[model samples]
Target: MAKKDDRGREGEERAARYLEERGYRVWDRNWRCPQGEIDIVADDGRDLVMVEVKTRRTDRFGHPFSAVDRRKRERLWRLAHAWMRAHPGAARGRSVRIDLIGITGERPATAVLEHLEDLR
Candidate 1:
């Protein structure tokens, strides 16, 4: 795989671990529908969180969170709706929120991670 792809996967894993540690029950990774992909689907008790994981090798270009543009957000919203429709039982009682997990640096080192809630 390409270097950037590998980095992104690593970031997603890190985000999963972080959420797990915080008591989020992870339901899916890379949940896909016709609209787009959701990096993580987790149940946070009262809500379902659709997460976007962004990883950057360096902070020189920009922060990883900045990568989530308007079009991407819209696609994620559509995908989340599709996921809920496909699993109506899981959808009814809970709220939906879009979250962002930004990670910086390499593996085997301290990766800086930030969780931004309710992005959409």
Candidate 2:
């Protein structure tokens, strides 16, 4: 795989560990529908969180979170609903939430991670 792709996969793995360490129960990784892919799907007790992970070797352009623009957020909501429909009662009474995990560094395992939860 390309170096960039490796970094992204590493970032997702690190992000999953980060969330798991914080007590989030991760149920899915790289979940996809016709719309797009949700990097991570987890339950944080009260809600189902759809996570978007963006990894950058450096911040020369901008923070990874900047990639998740308003249009992207809207798309995530659509994908979240699509996932719920596909999974039936998996989300029962919990609300759906969007989260962004941004990682920047040469090594994703030791990269600086910034997590923005409950994105709007």
Every model's TM-score: 0.93, 0.97
Q: Candidate 2 on 60-83: residue-level lDDT in tens?
A: 999999988999999999999999
- Model 1 is weakest, by summed lDDT over 10 consecutive residues, at 102-111
Candidate 2 ranges beyond 4 A from true positions: none
Count clashing residue pairs in model 1.
Answer: 0
Compared with the true structure, what per-residue lDDT tens digits does model 1 show for residues 27-86?
999988777788999998889999999888777889888888998889878888998998
Which structure among the candidates has the greatest TM-score? Answer: 2
Off by over 4 Å in 1: none
Per-residue lDDT, model 2, residue 111, is 89
lDDT of each: 0.88, 0.94
